[model samples]
Target: MTVIRINAITVPADSGDELAHRFAARAGAVDGADGFEGFELLKPTDGRDQWLVVTRWRDDAAFQAWLDSPAFAHGHRSESERGGGEAQRPVSSHSEVWSYEIAGGSPA
Candidate 1:
């Protein structure tokens, strides 16, 4: 079965735009990764401040490989280097990941 990872974050209104910009810059970098099925940056549409970063992989092994890949480190390197900068500052509360296996679904 396909594996899906959902990383949800809550940030201030101002931070959401910044986050989106960062995501846009980095999202394409993951395109060539192995087992990378697809990706989505879900923004709030109902006046909420929540965002969901969704990624799909071939399987659990693929997802794990991504976590252990250089691309993963490269993608997050800025975060650790500066000890979290303005790019990460707006996450006022916290973030969490929700994973799921694609049991069944319909095409859009």
Candidate 2:
């Protein structure tokens, strides 16, 4: 069954652009991962401060494999950790991951 991982990032009101830019900077970073199905960065339209990073995988093992891969660590490293000068300030003040499966949906 397809598995979904949603990273719910909470940023300050003024940091949304920065968060998007950071995500854009590393766009396609996970494309080559095994069993990586798809990805989407969702921006909140209402008066909420939470953004969502949604990723779909072939299965839990696929997702776990990606998490255990070096690419995942590399992609998640801070700029400074990657040998850039000073580390940039974090855009999101809080975040969390929500997991789910395709319970039901119309055929696409």
Best by TM-score: 2
Reference-based lDDT, residue 106, model 1: 97
Worst 10 residues of 1 by lDDT: 82-91
TM-score of 1: 0.82
On lDDT, the candidate that comes out on top is 2
Per-model TM against the reference: 0.82, 0.93
CA lDDT of each prediction against the hidden true structure: 0.80, 0.92
lDDT of 1 by residue, 14-84 (tens): 78777887777666777888889999999999988879989999888988988898888878655535366
Query: Which ranges in model 1 have alpha carbons more than 4 Å from their true place?
Result: 79-92
